[model samples]
Target: MSSEHTPPPRQQPTFLTAVAALEAVVADLDDEGFGPALGLVGGLFGSADPSEAAAAGPRLAALLPDAPPFPRAHLAMVVGACVEQGADPVACSGPVLAGLRGALTGAQRLVEGWERTGGGPLPDPEQDDPAEAHERIADPAVLDAWHAHLAVVAWWTLHLWQRAAWAVYAHPAVRTEARGSGVTAALLGLIRRYRGEQHDLKGLAHLAGMLDDEPLLVLDRPTGTGYLLRMSGLSDTFQLHTLLADVLIGGGHLPGVPQDPQVVALARTEFLDGRRVIATGAFNLVAPDGSWLWNEGTPSDIPVVDGVRTLVLDPLPYERSWSAGRFIQEIPGDLRLERVLSPAEAARLLATTAPARSAQQAFGAGQA
Candidate 1:
């Protein structure tokens, strides 16, 4: 309820969302609320307009004084993020850099009174509040290791997300036990790829949107580093980060076979980076009424991919979440559609009173 808050750019679609997220954490924060600002850091990193993003530098700078290295380290990083997002470098520049320059000149050590002022649960980079990672430490060496690593965080441009993962692992104090803690293992995967190593495949979450749904694709088969997410890899998008959730997923579909090396090579093209490359997955969409029907020529996990029918996984409830490849796929995997449906289940839940093929004169293909 503070009057001094920097007003959000109302033109941006997520303005209300940003306010809500901030309010959820600390409702009574005034303009200078450092904790509230950090909780809203996601909004800052995700600013869509260049002019809006330009304000991030000084905004984040305001928090450095009241924060630990966790946030002080973020001071320089905010500028780097704005640069990557295409904000005008000089316009986005602010007095924050002077403070950033001065802070780094000191030798790294645990803050003078972290034990008295610290010790909390570790935060989940994806789901929890970013400022909640502060907690006191009994292990001075590990705390010192965390202190040194966090204090030195720079742009880390290509994978800015590593900064957060590194922050969490840097604190083994088990602080801010929010939820979801795969960040450390995920980071090691980055290290492995940096060394030119191989990783096994798992399902990856394929994110989507309204008809113009799902972002684009990137094939990450690399000589120097490995892929970010595998097509047949892990389906959970949090394998990246929340920032990644909005930025990386959903590249429009390009048809290919997973077993063919040529198709796989095509998938690795630079065009698909930070986007999804298709491999026989159905992006079946349904109406708000829970009707899983689509007219021909609409793109995505096509209900019919090259003659094979797709099984729309859990589409009885129409929504965007089920539109990803993981939810819709070529018929036959671990899931099977049952012929047996109770009259109520089909008529009400499935939105069909009877099977009418193609609604031919009101008797087309549908529930029987």
Candidate 2:
């Protein structure tokens, strides 16, 4: 036995093995394991090159012609993977985007089917196991939720393609190796705008769903302050330490405060005099404007002109209503200011908030 046993057919390299595994997942797309299989494929080849995507594209495309609408949307995403991986933008973008649009149309059809059938409540993946939830898409509400989620995914893929196309022609912002291009910055702005529009739509949908609705007041906080104080109900926390980080501080897309100029000046005076900034009426109070005050030795009262409202920052420490210590205490021991998060990590936070809100609506229906 010690004589010349062929060394176990030399195991494939890790990258090769990964490629095989991803190809297998793509091959299995039509099977019962479609959900997990799609996820596996994404994990394996999401960042892989066009060559890798090309290897699996045939198998992925095999199922798409007859695939269900939701699954079809997933296939579109897989197609995006190939495009993102160094494909010729002009030749490929048109076909790829066309395919994605078709997927979106299919998704819309699925939603229509749900509405026609009067489908059931949305499934919570956290609350329900995969096996139980896999085949439960008959419900309209559930389908709507899925539609929203999928739309976000598909649009994100498109956004990425736009970025990749932009990168080809655009110059880098920094000459250093890891520097971002102007394309990336532009994409960020587009993403911010898209996210804001989506968020405002969701907020409107949520608000409309409420039984006793009140007027909406959008507030923007002043920028350039060393710190932002966030108040939701009686609790206050520094913006950096908030659960969603800077999102709560600077992620407003709606119009600003609409108070009279005279009222804003008076508010500024009260703010300067160290009056507590409290919500008197029903308002969607948001963060302050950047660079409005914070300089010139006095904090500017966030302007509330038209419908835009800015945060009123007090330059004087003794005159301020919120204490730094109080805000500091609200932060958890585990929270860190400077931490790099993977997409997966950042997504987990969003995963909780959206589902929780959905669950509230789902369960609250019985109470009514």
lDDT of 1 by residue, 196-306 (tens): 111121211121111121222222111111112212211232111111222222321222222222223322222333345433222232322223443221223333322
Off by over 4 Å in 2: 1-6, 13-75, 90-106, 109-368
Question: Over the stretch 1-368, how does candidate 2's per-residue lDDT look in tens digits?
Answer: 47775566765334235545545654655455556555666666745656766555445544444444445555545654554454333333333334434433433443344345465543332354433333333345556556544533343333333332232222111111111223223322333334222112222111111111111122222221221232221112221122222232223321233333322233222222443333212121223322222111111123443442223221222221221211212112111123233445434322322111232442364355
Ten contiguous residues with the weakest lDDT in model 2: 206-215
Stretches of model 1 off by over 4 angstroms after superposition: 1-33, 55-69, 91-96, 108-368
lDDT of 1 at 266: 29
Q: Count the backbone clashes (under 3 Å) in each candidate.
A: 50, 22
Instruction: Give the alpha-carbon lDDT of every model.
Output: 0.30, 0.33
Q: Note each model's CA RMSD in angstroms.
A: 21.7, 18.2
